[model samples]
Target: MIHIVFNEADIPVLQQAISLDESLQGEVVVIRDDYAVGPLDHTYAGEGREARLNWWREVLAGGDYEGKTDTGEVDDFKTVAELVGTLRRNPEETIWIWAAQNKHDVSGYYWLLHFMKEFQGRVFILYLNNLPFLSEKGQLFYPIWLHSIPPKEFLKAKKLARPITLSEFEVDPDEWIRLCQEKKLVRILEGGKKLSQHDADFYDIDLAKFITVDWQKASKIINQFQHKNKHTTGDAFLLWRLKKLISDGGFDTQGEIRNMKDFEIKLKSQHQAETA
Candidate 1:
């Protein structure tokens, strides 16, 4: 079962996700951030954060629901946990929600939860940045956790670590290497259209270039080639390399994977995490 959470802006995206999950029977919850915590009715005296937190705690104790938190404004998480618990007796089956702040990126909110310990490790995060219902176009990005892994709310690194892999469906590694070796600026083998490696190359370099660049152009070409050729470009071999990297503690170059490793160790020592 999938629990969906969303604000007004996320209505369309959330609706789409629900529609796609037609086979998965589940519940959908909505939180009007503008009116949460009895904002207009005036539930608590100082009932802003404190009231919200209290609501969450009560919800957590209730343990009835599972779904996304709508902007984490009201006792959203608490309520979500309550329901998620009913569906998931074993912690493994549980799903929790934490709504994120809009704009820029999720890093800020990610750190906020991490440092504040806002999560209890039982729920998952469904990012709503991409939701068209969002005032900001809500593009429907996938779920994201910071460097924080499962089952805890703690910050890892300012620059979070995430996994990335090249899909070899179009261009094989050998072909890419060969193109690079040949110094070819343009190659168009797949993707239903030809691509120019570079009709032009940028001379100026910026800080974001190195960090954000995925070399997608190169990877996609190879993936496309593989598809057109009706052949597999060795996903099994790549998975092996990925395993080795995880073992070696590969992560963002920000040097923060160490903290993630530390938290992982601590969690392991305290209780045996099923996935560990």
Candidate 2:
């Protein structure tokens, strides 16, 4: 089954699309995690549960409401696992779509992550309003309340069952830089040329007089400039530099990164650059 993961920036729109497509109508289910209980039902209290029931009434009408929302408040890890297994083995087409409504609502991932491991079904993620560091491409499961990792990245990283670093997913660092450069936002480097993906990381990147070696050096430069110079400070620069430095796409618990497309892209792009 094919799954398309999207950010929660467009939930109402997504709900509309899911509603319109007969094939997709009943196939998709949304899961939400609870956060700080507000003066109202923000914390998924009895009222929050009832509120959620009402919200889904309009959203999931004509489809099964189930009248049940699984909050981590209860310990039902095994039940969740079983549900995932059943969904995956179901002959009917289906999509388990999760909406991380708030930044602190990351507890939802615990169960979903467990489910995905056992169930071989399509899974998609959506991150609604999130905090900084947790908004990396729509995932908010980082250390700072589930740091902002991309939803797909978070899913893959969870499957790997390890802490994620930038290098874990970024195979084509130079290619990524090129994409940034094409956008003409790469200025932290003088003549920053591409390098093999292995060279980009938090440490062990030798410039050797090249413009910019990899993301590792770029972050050091940015942080140094801010710490030592104090002349440059901005979210844009930090993000750009961080994105550049953290493109290593390193290994997993198996001690290997086997995604060929990411590595292959670098060589293919480099060859094209050389020929052109």
> For residues 26-100, what per-residue lDDT tens digits would candidate 2 score against the true structure?
432334322111112232246644564454333222222222333333323344444556566775544343433
**Alpha-carbon lDDT of model 1:** 0.30
RMSD per prediction, one decimal? 24.1, 22.5
What are the lDDT figures for the candidates, one per model? 0.30, 0.32
Q: Give candidate 2 regions above 4 Å deviation.
A: 1-15, 27-82, 91-94, 126-276
TM-score of each: 0.25, 0.25
lDDT of 1 by residue, 1-276 (tens): 333333444444444444554433345554333221111112222444455444434333312221223345545345545654565565444342334433111212221222112223433454433222211243433332211121111121111322111322123333333333343322322321122232111111111122122322222322343354422222222222222333443222322222112211111222323434
Worst 10 residues of 2 by lDDT: 251-260
Candidate 1 stretches greater than 4 Å from native = 23-25, 34-78, 84-92, 96-122, 128-276
lDDT of 1 at 8: 44
Q: How high a TM-score does candidate 1 get?
A: 0.25
